[model samples]
Target: MDDAHRTRWTRRTLDWLRTEVGSALLLVGVVLVALAWANSPFSGAYEHLWELPVHVDAGDLRFDMDLHHWVNDGLMVLFFFVVGLEVRQELAVGALRQRNRRLVPLVAGALGVLTPAAVYLVIAGRDAPTGWGVVIGTDTAFLLGVLALVGPAMSNQLRIFLLTLSVVDDFIAVTVIGTVYSDDVRPGPLVLAAACLLALWLLGRAREWRSTPYVLVVVVLWGATVQAGVHPSLAGMLAGLLVPAASPEREDVVRAKHLFRSYWQSPNAGVARVVGLGLARSISVNHRLHEQLRTPVSLVVVPVFAFANAGIDLRGGALGEAFGSTVLWGVVAGLVAGKLVGISLGAWAAVRAGLGELPDGVGPGSVVGGAALSGIGFTVSLLIADLAFEDEADTQAAAIGVLVAMVLSSLVGAFAFRVARVRFGEHSADLPVTLTPDVDVERDHLRGPAGAPYTVVEYLDFQCPFCARATGMGQDLADHFGDQIRYVVRHLPLEDVHPQAFGAALAAEAAHRQGAFWEMHDVLFANQARLEPDDLRGYALELGLDVERFDRDMADETLAERVRAHAESARASGAQGTPTFFLNGVRNQGSHDARTLIAALEESLPEAAVRRRS
Candidate 1:
């Protein structure tokens, strides 16, 4: 990942968090309104409204359901579908793609699921074992919202960890719903549903891009699943899983760009449609659907589901009875205590076993706080309560339990973060802000006068497209500042994403041996599409260096070590992705455009110089 891509990802993540937080606040308000209406003089009306029968009949396709059932069994499919889309994307290219990255969260989330059920079983003690699944899920919206409210100011790493864990939790919860909570299966419809799913698989295998086909097939699959005595929502998840997800290919992007340019020149309906389709095809179906559905799922489906389901009447001593009910206490203890212990223990064990490490800047305390917040199981918990219990009283008890767990979990998470800050002195919530091992004019690659008043350093990947765009910024800044600016470039090649990057970094080091480092740098960035060993050798030969010496230097372990050391220094300086810039000793936190770089460099100058520039 380059800095531009990483920055966009970070911005998207923050945007997602904000959206989820707003959705959570809306869900919370809806829940409160529901509770108020349920307990108010219009209590009967509340029940009557949801219980109102809704019927849909279309040429032998007959359906009869209450308003509540329509929301749960129908509209909520979109919710599960969106969740499945996210899971597929993550497994394909997002955070969960790497096994090492998935390890800690996978273990922690699995334990987080099981431990809660165990707690529920122990506490419920033969009273309501069927309700154990209620505690298995963490409501991601509410969890994120609560984390925002109680967690440290800069908690990007912790938020990412918790989000990954929550995704795992959701996957498990849906699996349990499909298998454990569904009605008895029927052979004929089961086979039909299987056939429909097979059709979905075929569509995926064919890499179908049109949404209409997928939507129609998924709807038919849902009906088949319902008839098969499976949860229809599971069909949604399964359908979503079958949708192909992959990063956009460079060729596809270039084609889309060309199509857009054509549309810009033509400005007609035919050209516009071509551009739209081209741009849509540049992204995966999974991403396209996720973008289209996430807002509706978050803003409407979830809130409507809450309104329909969460209106439990706490009248006639129901609240007092809930306090005494084992089911209520079971859910509360299961989520609040079990999640904390299980997540912490699982993470600790994973680290001990060398399975995976926590995200950078996340500590034991942050883990604990995140674990506590994992107890907030509002949405899916309520759904499970509806599925698990036949008795209304037990269901109400579980709902109350979920509400109480949410409050207790929030308080516990707050306390844990507070303790982490005060007692442990783990105050900083972001990665290190200062550059490590200050730039050395003698040791570093310098582009201008060594004694320049203003200094700019960049940790860069040679194969990264974003870094390639930034390659000329050094010369631009030098031009703008005359000899007053010194530009330093350090290798931080991201080998996982950019496989050719490490070798390219080594090529640069080899070129440095022949005093043509900048020449080789420009060539490599220019020919980013070709950075193999032969390409590097050809570029070296074109630079008029002794190819023999360059080859010898490229083979030197010292050059590789030098590159690795620079990567380590990049990490230490909070540069997770390249090209990461430092103005003076501080990390640059703005855009990487040459104009922006020039302005930032001007600001980094001495006060007198800055004033003169102003």
Candidate 2:
């Protein structure tokens, strides 16, 4: 794709992943097409096409597998790698980063796995106990998609809970695939695979940021895994784990902007290439791969896998026999009934034991609904079903069971959420939507004209380096719009991470008493590393403020409370990090770059004003 198309597709894909309904519908459509083609006169062609041999040969190495194996072993590697990236991200900075926030979901997820496996074994022990792993996973794509369709109007809290739970499920599912379901052991190749994995670890430890090195290593690792007779999915996941995934550092962002400015001034291929590479390097490789790969994997790789695997020929009494067998009912009960009970009871027990509390807005009914939706286990469930059962009839039965469970679980979840809304009156389980306690000129420290037509409000922590960089971007916006834009900054001192932030906010407020708030603001951002009490006092002296009055005001409890109030307002406005922006009272969804923010401001202006400005 061209850059424009690529950008648009990536944005749409992220939105679909976030909202979840579109991708699920696409998956469902693909599955329907597969079934239709399988049952049609072209049915014979379906199996024949996938069974065609694929061959790969190197100078002294050769590998051969059918198209089906290629899909399972090859393209699916990207899917698992993306999953691993997400898991790593969660562990680093997402929901699971906080120990207390992660505890309840971890407990519930573990139980969710065990309970389903237990239920499956109970129902199908004598017949197909090995297939218990089939029900141990929840397909994140389908779960989120169906949840969006059937969940509460505002389900962010519950969504985070379920997403966190799925991370655990994914971990166990991949472990089972690699160990419990691998082919016969091959020690020499397995040893080589281990060495490759160690190399990956070493690269990460050494902070190797280049994507090319990681890619080369992963390719060799996958080949070793295939030769080792272990499932390559595990190799993919392990490689992903070793790929660093960190948020962009402020210094790196500033460097990227500098590189861009050089390219802007020179406008040559070499500088453009340098600028591109610089921008890419600012973002972690793991995050970049996830963003670029998730869409194609969801839309293409997964649908192809489904088409290859989900084509069950259920004619000639096959459908009746499949349903009649214990395997089908075992999967149904294990996923649908077991997941609901296990997750619900697990969450309850965790809360009772004070392990951790549920996310803020998720009520019990929402949890119940989310747990039911978790039963929609399609992708990994089907993969496990194929590995768990050698008998074609057994696999067919399990596949039918999965499809049936998806429909049933969706219905059950919808019913639960409906009951939640109507009976318990629990609705809107997400963060506050609009800017809370709308900005006032008298209250907020404002830049630009007081009566400016356009407004941009930023929630910032004085000690946050990102916030420091954002100060320049804010100035750029002010420069572009001049008196037409009013810029406001609210204190959102993340005291846990930025210890001196609260004190700095109070210092700014104290300076406001001497008509030097802007002076202190510029000084604090400029010298973010030194924000101790003594440093604040020094800054007041530097700003020509009355030192006695400033120190007394900084000591005032009411100033501290004002800072606290601003922090509370930031939270109420759904800002969890520094440098969150609100444009014309609406939250900015993506980047807060001057260009993007300027475009938004121009769009909001009257047509006559915009034309005149242009």
Best by TM-score: 2
Report lDDT (Cα) of residue 130, candidate 2. 82
Evaluate all candidate structures by whole-model CA lDDT and list the values in order: 0.87, 0.88
TM-score of candidate 2 versus the correct structure, residues matched by position: 0.93
Candidate 2: RMSD to truth: 3.4
lDDT of 2: 0.88
lDDT of 1 at 323: 92
Q: What TM-scores do the predictions have?
A: 0.87, 0.93
Off by over 4 Å in 2: 1-19, 468-471, 599-614
Residue 426, model 1, lDDT: 71
Which model scores highest in lDDT?
Answer: 2
Q: C-alpha displacement of 604 in model 1, angstroms?
A: 10
* Model 1 spans > 4 angstroms off: 1-18, 428-430, 437-458, 470-488, 496-499, 513-515, 578-614
